[model samples]
Target: MTDPDGPSGTATAVPEPPEKAAGTRGRRRALRHPLARFLLRRVLIAVLLAWGITVVTFVLTNLVPGDPATANLGQRALGDPAIVAQWRQDHGLDKPLPQQYLIHLGGMLQGDLGVSQQSHRPVSQDLAETVPATLELAGAAIVVSLILGVAFGVVAALRRDRLPDHVLRVLSLIGISVPTFWLALVAFYVFFYRLQITPGSGRIDPGLQAPPPVTGLATVDSALAGQWDVFASAVGHLLTPALVLALYTIGLLTRFTRSAVLEVLGQDYVRAARAKGLPGRVILFRYVLRSALVPIITVAGLAFGSLLSGTVLVEAIFAWPGVGQYAYKSATTLDLPAVMGVGLVVGGVYLVINLIVDVLYGVIDPRVRLQ
Candidate 1:
């Protein structure tokens, strides 16, 4: 538009082309997408959450009653009060809580898990040795749970109120009701003890020569290292404990998926898709499943993390080489370093898994990518 004063002498300038304006609007629209903003906000939230978890975990672990020095020294070291005091002072346990936390935080940031009081070996060494086995088993178990749980759920949705649905619901209810530790014991008895169907304990058969340096996961590293015998042994040994752990996750996820899918099946798009000449299977899988995936993925992710914390009972029952067992042992021995070490591992595991879930959400849903 032009000024009115010089209309006869000068023509007013015209606005830019509509296409350019439209392009600018499109750019702004892309920037303002809910998914993009949600992801940005999520990242900030994750940082705050991680910091909060670290601080709270550190404080709580320290507050847990017991002296690391005494836990190590026992009656002989406690005989001379001066010796116990000296030991505490030497290890900096005598320092103020604030100072101790700062030191621990600094060391943790450097990826240094402090030494175990009871074992006298570095906590990091123990973690490096054990974490992989736990990860392998847990990872496989969760994957299986997700796949089978969702599959069962889809079947139930397809066959609502039918025999298969009732059967799955009953199975899930039983799985959810049984304590994992109790289930592990029963499973061990039935499968390993009575039927000799699966090996009850250990990651691999003793006869199978485990690698010299059991690097990463025994199963994974064995495969990578070309130890097929060890791999077979690991898989066989893993099936029982992994299935035991998987039971609850599968149950929880299946229930969640069934509910979500059933709800989605009632939506308008679902009806419209069916109203079209499209097959029922296409409407269920291609349309309904995509719509249902977000909530199902979320529940499944949280369930997986719960297993990470709650696997202690199962680990103890099965003698599975998991962090839960290590944590339980360390706590019993009042080993501060080991306790904190396992805590870090457990915390980091969930954090990373959650991050992966968020990324996957973006991947599967175009709306998330737009955000």
Candidate 2:
């Protein structure tokens, strides 16, 4: 052949294009930062999961027995073919399923969540108003649960087989086994109806108007606006439902934390710390608790995410104007757009919580980020 191999009988190496080489170098540089790599990986996974959520919600709503146009139009409007057709066309329900889905996805990307069939307002706007309320409730619940759960868990672990441990274990079992709805009903009856210690249902007293909507959380907004009376009212109104919602999570975290601390207690390093003659409190808090934090954080994250999404029954019972209530209303009314928005919000909550947990893992234990 015409000396294709040249003098050394070896082919020449092909040089990568400058653009390709730059991209490769950029990737390598990005990878060198463990935290950055971890964040990027987590973010990509979250995005993928979000996409799957959209797909699943879309398909399920479509498969469900109901026509959006008919549901929104009512019986009188559905009697008019022209009105029905116009409504379908206006909502893009006239398009092919694939095209409709693409349009829906595109609108979601652009922050347009469609118009709520029930409210006649933008779905995004409705969610914005409701989500903050749920956040406040869920936030309060998580704080209460974390404090009680961690304290009880540590005590249980320390006591091991003593009477305190047995009592706490029984209480936790009751908390876990009891249904939230029934507990909520009983708590509401005993606290609000019988004892009258807590205020009646709703976020605040009807007499005082809500403070300016800086945060949409009544307590926060009231405090920000220097409405101390309103703030106190908001807190009182919030306490009962929040505590009711927290019971299950408190139990779950208590059991899990006990296990985690017990596992850490068995580690060689923990034994070494004890052998070093450290104070009992110091050894327990400094070594066992610190090492057990990663698992505790994981459980807490999942519990918080569940609380945020699973508050429908509690919200309904308490008359709390929150995302859970909104979702329940939408589902009952067959408001598909609002339902989808709620689905997205719930799924996004889990994703964000998981990302936060992952980042916390890296922060608490540097070894986690290396993977």
Q: Per-residue CA lDDT of candidate 1, range 1-371, in tens?
A: 23323342332264546786566556556658767666666677777777777787789888888777767886887999899889888667888999988898888888877888767788998998778878877888898899999998888877899999999999989878888888889988998899998876888876777865656788777888898998888888888888888999899888988999999988999888877979877887799999889989898889888777657877787788778888989998878878888877888777777887897798678877764
Q: Against the hidden reference, what TM-scores do the models get? A: 0.86, 0.89
For candidate 1, give the lDDT of residue 87: 86
lDDT of 2 by residue, 1-371 (tens): 13322332232265657786566566667767889878888889989999999999888888889887766777999999999999989888899989988999999999989998899899999999999999999999999999999989989998899998999999999988888888889998998899999898889999998999998899999999999999999999999889889999999989998999989999999989988999999998889888898999989998997687558989999999999999999987889899999989988888888889988998778788887
Q: Which ten residues in a row have the lowest lDDT in candidate 1?
A: 3-12
Per-candidate clashes, comma-separated: 2, 0
Q: Candidate 1, clashing residue pairs?
A: 35-371, 36-371
Q: Weakest 10 consecutive residues, lDDT, candidate 2?
A: 1-10
